[model samples]
Target: MAETTAETTDVASQYSAQVASDLEQNLKEQERLSAEIEALQAQLAALQHNHSVLTNIQQALGTSAAAAVSAAESVTKVPAPRKKTATKAAASRRTKSQKPATATAKRAGKKTAKASQTQSAAQSAAPKLVELVRAHLSAQSEPRSAAEIAAALEQEQPERGIKTTVVRSTLEALVAKNQAQRTKQGSSVFYTSTDTAEPAADGDQSEQPSA
Candidate 1:
């Protein structure tokens, strides 16, 4: 009976030691699982933060792109106010350009008027050349050649540029008007006045062309 009691006590001590070891191993496994769970939670939180940042950046970019498109559209529209301003500027430039043309035209008109007035004054100042020729023909009692009449008129009025050709043309004109007589002796021609009018004083003739 003493031996059996000793064996029973030894078996109980062995079972107590095995139970303590098993309990210690179970606690270590639970600690390792807790650490792994904490690491996985940290990684998940970091991924969520990155996702939020990326979403915000995308939204900001989208807003900026929309604003840029709006600005482009506004520029392309070409509104009425801009058109009116451009038209007014063009009109102003045209008016400025036309001012010189208008001034030039006015100056040209004044010059033309002055030239006309001067020409009229010159015409009024000069005497009719036909009357001088008639008066010279009436003064002669005998028939005279065109050269002789031209020379006499040139001596009488040195300022008058008398020409023989012009005197011949005037004598022909007087014959055509029935105011003088033309006599042809061989190749030479002579003229005499048919009118019985009195003679004029110092007959002045010119080299003016016959009308």
Candidate 2:
């Protein structure tokens, strides 16, 4: 009876020890899972906060860009006060009558030379005016009157300040150069153009043939 009692006691003690060990292992596993869940929650909160901050920053940048674009559009659409501008075209050069050497023949001086250079602008015809007159005369198939040539030059060079005198002088110079012929009847003058003809009869003195 004593021996049976001792055996029974030993078996019960061994079973109790095994159960306690299993319970300890289960508690340790539960603790590990709880810590892992807490870390995950913390990470999720941080991610949500970061996403919100990034979204706000993007919205602010978009608003600023829209404002800048609106400002640029307004600037382009609005007209500024206009500035008045004056033309200096007439002052750029002297008139045709301002260039010649009439006073130098009467009285020669430094002042006279300076005056001559500025005033005697008429003595030498403008190269541009001469060329314009020649081109017009050459293009026409028939003799054009002085008035006709002046009117044509007016259309051709509205910029050079064309006048009747400039055209008349240019035609006369052309006659002198033998590039053209001049015909005068009563008070009317007309120009007849020619091409590569036997060189002028005495080129230097090739003035308009006396009527």
Best by TM-score: 1
User: What lDDT does model 2 reach?
Assistant: 0.63
The lowest-lDDT stretch of 10 consecutive residues in candidate 2 is 91-100
Off by over 4 Å in 1: 1-90, 113-129, 140-143, 152-162, 182-190, 196-211
Return the number of clashes found in candidate 2. 8
Instruction: Give the clashing residue pairs of candidate 2, or none.
Output: 98-119, 98-121, 99-120, 99-121, 99-122, 100-120, 100-121, 100-122
TM-score of 2: 0.32
Number of colliding residue pairs in model 1: 0
Model 2 Cα lDDT, one tens digit per residue, 31-84: 556545654564577578657755765565565556555644544454443543
Task: Name the lDDT value of residue 167 in candidate 2.
Answer: 66
Flag regions of model 2 displaced more than 4 Å: 1-127, 196-211
Candidate 1, residues 118-163, lDDT tens digits: the string is: 7568757866556777888888887789889889888976664666
